[model samples]
Target: MKDSEADSRSHKPCVPFGRIAVLGAGSWGTALASILARNGHDVRLWARRPALAEAINKTGMNGDYLADVPLPESLTATASIAEALADVDAVLMVTPSSTLRAMCEAIKPHLPDAAPIALACKGVERGTGYLLSEVVTDALPGHPVGCVSGPTFAREAALDHPTAATVAFPFSYEDRLNPEKSPAARLAMSLSGGGFRPYVSDDLVGVEVGGAVKNVIAIACGMMSGAGFAENTRAALITRGIDEMKLLAQALGGKRETVTGLSGAGDLTLTCSSTTSRNMSLGFQLGQGTARAACFEGRPVVVEGEVNSVSVTELAARVGVSMPICETVNAVLHDGADLRAAFTALWARPIEAEPYALELSLAHPSPNLPLQFGDT
Candidate 1:
């Protein structure tokens, strides 16, 4: 196909974006890199360990994550942050939530002043209780940051299965100084691979909170499955899960509509129904005869819901949103409450109205204008 024809086919308004960096070598990062490379962008997958980078370069695969999934030849793996970020237009960060702050700090000196970042992590920070975007903006102030979230599983996405996600910009992406360049628009184009649909949203909080909290609810569902409960039990957990997710999102200044969109309801459904979910799997083992220590002893992947249970519960409490399911999960996980006892406590709570009521106010948007990023 002609270059112009290819560009048109790819749905991008402009020419190719040079050297896009994915700042993590985990399953999600590797998968995203493969998609971007197939779209004809120069893509780099960053690994902290040099051996992992070398392995990917030599084997044409990421055995640790993708398990023999063939990677695109156009994708390159690198250990050097400078090598990945230098001359890059945009970056997608799939790092663990705990490491996001540190990773951004390390990438800051090498990052272009106006480079937009799209974070794929799905957990809030521990202790301080910051969302992924809050962590990003705090570390890289003045930079444009967005989030990619929904029901996407990295393995499915890598296999080119049909998948969809939300691309959220908390701040405006179009430059006030130069109206022609919108980094979010360009980044969305670069991320849309075959069978992967990217929908745009301005509800960053709703998108992110949905992504972060669904895993917690999924764990509760897993316990139901593992304990030999029927589908009615699972359905109830999912129903209550959405209610809490919406309440938490709105309490944090996000809209109700965004909470009900792809990132919220879609992701919750996917996570709750499948044992493929890391958090659900972990919860399954817990609900069965296995101990928590035994369940996670040799697990290689991060069970984000395990972490989010604590953070989300805390965030809701501080913000005055009631989430009994999340609180029950937290108690079971951390406070050593017996699984049966935890369930009983939740079951015995005083019943309220069908939906919760709360006074929610959105944060005043940042006064910063869009920063120039991609080629004009």
Candidate 2:
């Protein structure tokens, strides 16, 4: 195999934690567990079903969702949520954005000693449109919260396909991990394998915003592609997508750089263009004029963007940001706006000189200067 391919097989190591818990048993959750085990760490995958846990432990594989690839032999599974959390040094929460609060509440008594909690899920809360990081922080007071996201697809990660991601968390003012010296930072530094690369940032808010909003934009791209629209139109949608994402990220006190990095622009590019993405696939079907219920037939996989569309629209209105693309998506999906009519409505809006990036900062509460991404 080539060097990149070899790297994909099992990357290097900064160091390994004693134990880590992955709360969800879905495809993405399973893939992350496999990655950790491949890098020589102890990983505990918690599922709600005893049968599923037994299948993984006995067969050394996930029988569903992630059946496309065999799970690492070293990976373990458990049905008890506490059993998974006990003795763990870190927690990787991979549950759906909507279910995050309840899951954390259930595991509240079991939370270990300030272990870093990494969020791998993306989406705005339905009623409040809160980002995953915000929800985690609010639910688990004083805990070290972080998030990881980008153009990652679970099947590709399993296959060791070349991919890049971003890891963002508030830098501890006291126990800050020196990207140069701290073992945890170094371990995270070496976490990327093969075609997988992970970039570390201190901009938790920015990373969260990028991950959450990209799904919404992917739906728009899917619709355009499904409708056989030209590249020029898709380009317009993507540009507007970035603008809307930037507007919200700024509103939520995120750094501008975070939205421009791997997790932001990079992720947007991949999810919007790929037919493989569930969000894009759903949009494509919608654009092709398929009824929502008919196109979603038997596909239970979470597209994330479908649900985020309305939340994003509401957020834009609250912040007073103009997001034509997001508005169009919300109209089509929720307000029963005709697909073609919605698209046309966006074009019908007035055009003006592009707003300066600073306008976004003016739209929300000014945020503190970011420490990590600023100089790096």
Candidate 3:
């Protein structure tokens, strides 16, 4: 269906929920809160600083993060978690991955048991290597948990540009029986409106993995761009990056097709090709000979790829997945490997057939077959 038609159909004047607490007043969080408010929901946005909350409440704008877009009057800001969660029907956790656990712990006491939690953040937990969905489930057990992700930039989304995303929530037996009444369906409905379309799925792991791994891949693409590589090189990285994403997703028990879906291929293309992405921009700086410290010295926003590179590489090793691109990014960013040298090494690696072709060859060996790297 056309996006405009979908937007009109999905937002046919349904009664909005009672209240939604959007924890985290960053660009992404504020944008999402604005969408909910625009959809006629009462959205309470939580900011870390009381001053920022006061400013947003007074001016109806998140000047620090989203200076250009004016937030809806229905969307209010607060610094107190208790006030935000007081009578909330749902919660959207949009904080950084590294601090998600602490945020969940802080909200547990105030959160309603019946309220579902939807994660808008990307990336796995830093030390535990847990996907954001897993982290939420672990910290806030008994609450229905899901995630919303796709190729979306906060500014565009806040401005009401056409946007679509995957809203994934693993259904329980009961949820499957009453699909319409399920948390997944409700969350999808609540989040869809104002030129924003959300497609539903049951692949929670696939969604989270795609969202996390794509950031790492975007950094690699940015590095190639910074190093003066052409479109051909960037194309190659994106193609191979999908393979890496699929391998890791499957190793972690997610569907391979999910890696090729909106949260994966769609997101990868947008982030890797755009400097608006924090991860890609950070990689570009590194590629231009800027020190990691210098790149991040005065930056207010967190560059998720720099942080996820370490956890993603570790997770790949633990799952025995071969993600050379992600590993190289981790090496360059965290281990201080020389950027040009790393790219040189990557290019110097032995040539191999595409993954599917190699699989086919493995299933049917022949004397005339080209020798592969591991062939005896």
Task: List lDDT for all candidates, in order.
Answer: 0.83, 0.79, 0.86
lDDT of 1 by residue, 193-213 (tens): 698888877788999999988
For model 3, the stretches where C-alpha displacement exceeds 4 angstroms are: 1-16, 357-376
Colliding pairs, model 2: 7-194, 8-194, 162-195, 163-195
lDDT of 2 by residue, 213-301 (tens): 88888998888788777688778877878877888888878887788888888889888888788888899998887888778785666
Query: What is the Cα-based TM-score of model 3?
Result: 0.90
TM-score of 1: 0.88
Best by lDDT: 3
Question: What TM-score, computed on C-alpha atoms, does each candidate reach?
Answer: 0.88, 0.86, 0.90
Using TM-score as the yardstick, the better of models 1 and 2 is: 1
Backbone clash count, each prediction separately: 0, 4, 0
Least well predicted 10-residue stretch by lDDT in candidate 3? 367-376
* Runs in model 1 lying further than 4 Å from the true structure: 1-16, 173-181, 357-376
The local lDDT score (0 to 100) that residue 327 gets in candidate 2 is 81
Better of 1 and 2 by lDDT: 1
The sequence of per-residue lDDT tens digits that candidate 3 reaches over residues 93-158 is 999988899999999999987688889998978778799888988988998889889999999999
